[model samples]
Target: MADENQGFMGAVWETIKTIFWALIIAGVFRTLFFQPFWIPSSSMKDTLLVGDFLFVNKMAYGYSYASCPNIKIARFGIDIDADDICGFLDGDNTRVLAGEPERGDVVVFRHPVTHQDYIKRLIGLPGDRVQVKEGLIYINDEPVKVEDGGTFTEVKEAQGPERRFPRCSNDPVGEGGQCVKERQIETLPNGVTHSTLNITDRGDLDTTKVFTVPEGEYFFMGDNRDNSTDSRVAQTSFGVGFVPYENLIGRADRIMFSSAGRSMLFFWTWRSDRFFKGIE
Candidate 1:
C-alpha cells in the first residue's frame, strides 16, 4: 500500500514539472520571437478582417527591456507599450538588437491616449510630409496612385430587431438598406500595393493639413479610411496621432486563422480561406 501511494505521488510531481516546463518554454518564445494578435475592429478591413488572427513578429524590431513588462504578466491594468515613447533606456535594461520598419509595413503599436494596441499601415516615416486631399494620400507633395477597384458589400443576417444603420451616400442605393463601401487599390511610393475602403468622398477626414512627420515619429492610417480614427486626426482630438518608434510592438507577418465571432464548434463560421494568408 505504501509503495502504491509513493508511486502515485511521484507521477503527480512529474506531471507538475512537465506542465511548468511547457509554460516557461511557451512564454519565452512568445516574448522573444513572436506573439499572436487578433483583429477586433474593421479598421484594417480588406487587408485584415474583424476576426483575423495574426502572428506578430516581435523580433522584427528587437527587444527592449526598457519597454513595459508584458501585460499578461505585469497585470498593470494598463495598455501602454513596454518601452517609453521617448525611447528612454533604463540603466539596467538595454535593447537586445536594432531594427526599423519601412514605409509600407503593417505594425502593431500602443496608442498614446488609450494605451491600447492598434494595428495600422505605416504611411508616413520620419521627416516625410503627408496629407490627404479629396480622399487621396499625398506624400511629399506627390500623390500616391490609386486604381478604382469597385464597390464592397457587407452582408449580415439580422440577429435581433431591424435597426437603421447610417451609411455613406455612395453606398448602393438599396431599397431595403444595405451596407456598402467603395474599394480602391492604393499604391505606395515603395511600390507596395493594398486595397482601401472609402465610405465617403467628402468626409472631414478626406481633406487634411500637411503633416510633416517629426524627427522620431511615424504616421499610421487604417485601410478603412472613412471609419478609422488614425493619424489623420490630432492626438488632442482623441485620435491616434504621430506614434513614437518605441511604441511599436511588432510587424504583422501572417494571418494564422479567422472566425466570424461564432462558436468555434460551428465549423461554418470558420473563415477557412483566410487561414495562413499572408498580409500584403
Candidate 2:
C-alpha cells in the first residue's frame, strides 16, 4: 500500500511538470509567433464580422515587449505588409506612427477618441487626398473600384418588415434611415485594385475642408459610413477626428473561428453555421 501511494504521487508530479512546460511554450508562441484576437464590432461588417475569433501572425511583421507586459524594450505592435493589419495586443494600447499601414488592407487600430481597438479598411494613405462623394471613395483624384459579391440577402427581424440585408450586404436606398449600399472595386495610383462597399445618399460627401492623410497621422472612415463616426468629424467635437499613428494596433489577418451570440443556458442554441467561415 505504501509503495502504491508513492507511485501515485510521483505520477502526479510528472503530470504537473508536463502541464507547466506546455503552458510556458504556449505563452511564448502566442506572444512571439502568433496571437489571437476577437472581433467585437460591425465596423468591418462583411469583411470581419463581430464575434469572430482570429489568429494573428505576430511575426508577419515583428514584435516588441513594449506592447506585452512582463518584459522591457517594448514593441508597439507588428508592422504589417498590407494596408489593413490585425492581431492586436491590447485594444487601447497601440502605437501606429512607426510604420505605414498600406491601402485596401483591413486593419485593427486604436480608435482616436475612445482608444478602443477598431478595425477599418485603409482607403487613403499618407500625402493622399481622400474624399467620399456620393458614397464613392476617391483617392488622389482617381476612383477606386469595389468588387461585387452579389446582392446580400437577409431575413427581416419579426413582423412584415422589409427583407433583411446579410452581414456582408447593404440595403439599397435609405429606409429606416439606412442608405442603399453596393460593392465596387477600388483602383490605387499604382493600378492595384481592392474591394470596397458604399451606401448611396449616405455620409457627408462634400466637406468645406479637404482631408490629407497627414504625415505621421492616418485618416480613417468606417465601412458603415453614416453609421460610423470616424476621422470625418472632430473626435471631441462630435465624431472621430484625425487619428494619430500611435493609435494603431495591428493588421487583421484572417478569421479563425466565428459563432453567434447565444446567451441561452442550453447546448442546442449554440451558433454552428459561422464556425469556420473565412472572413471575406
Candidate 3:
C-alpha cells in the first residue's frame, strides 16, 4: 500500500510540472506573437461590431514583456513575498519592441483618461490639423467617406412573473437600444479629420484647441461620430492628442466571430450574414 501511494504521488508531481511548463511556453508565444481580444462595445460601428472576436499580433508593433514590469512585488515560485522598487520590462531600450503604426488602420489602445480599452481608426498624424466641422469630418480639407446609413437594433424580452412588458418590435425605431441617425465627415488643412452627425448643427465640442499634431502622436476617432466620445471630447483625447507609439495596444486585423444584439442564446439574432466579413 505504501508503494502504491508513493507511485500516485510521483505521477501527480510529474503532471503538475508538465502543466507549468506548457503554460509558460504558451504565454511566451502569445506575448511575442499573437494575442486574442474580445469586442465589448459599439463605439466603432459599421466597422467592428459588438461581440466580434479577434486576434492581435503583438510583435507587429513591439512591446516588451516580463513577469513583472511595474510591480515591486515578488513571487516565491509558489506564492507572494515582500516588495521593493518596481522594475519595468524594458531594460533601457532593450529593443524588444519594434515597428511603426500606419494610417487608415483600425487600432486598439489604452484610453488615455480611463485607461480602458478602445479601438478607432488612425487619422491625424503628428503635426496634422485635426477638426470636425458642422457635422462633417474633414482632414486636411478632404472628406472621409462614410456610408449613407448604418443602423442596428438591440432587443430585450421579459419572461413570465417578472413582468409587465414593453412592446416588442423588429423595427429599430421602436426597439430599445436602437439608434438611427445620419453621420457627417470632413478633413482639415493639416490632413487630420473626424466625424459628426449631419444635423447636430451646434455641438458643445465644435472647435478650439487647434492642436499642431505634436510629433510622435496620433489622432483617433470613432466611426459612429455623434455617438462616440472620442478625440473630439477634449477630456478623453489624451495620448492621441496625439497617440504616442507606446500607447498603442494592437491593430484590428479581422473578425474571428460576432454575435448580434447582445445574447448568443437566440440563434436567430446571430449576424450570420456578417460572418467572415472583411474589415477595413
Q: Tell me, by lDDT, which candidate is best.
A: 1
State the TM-score for model 1.
0.83
lDDT of 3 by residue, 175-231 (tens): 244444454443434343444333244555544344456676678777655445666
Q: Clash number for model 3?
A: 19
Among the numbered candidates, top TM-score falls to 1
For model 2, how does the per-residue alpha-carbon lDDT over 127-209 read when each residue is reduced to its tens digit?
Answer: 88887666666777765665664442323221111223333235343333332346555565666454445544534643324
Using lDDT as the yardstick, the better of models 2 and 3 is 3
Q: Ten consecutive residues with minimal summed lDDT in candidate 1? A: 157-166
Q: Write the per-residue lDDT of candidate 1 for residues 180-257, one digit (tens) a residue.
A: 789899999999899999888889999999999997679999998987889998885378999877667789979999
Instruction: Please list the residue runs of candidate 2 whose C-alpha ends up more than 4 Å from where it truly belongs after superposition.
Output: 1-27, 64-66, 69-100, 146-150, 157-181, 190-195, 204-208, 236-240, 263-280
As for candidate 1, its clashing pairs are 67-82, 67-83, 68-82, 68-83
What shift in Å separates residue 85 of candidate 3 from its native position after superposition? Answer: 13
Candidates 1 and 3 compared by TM-score, better number: 1
Ranking by lDDT: 1, 3, 2
What RMSD does each model have against the real structure? 4.5, 8.5, 7.0
- lDDT values for all models: 0.78, 0.54, 0.56
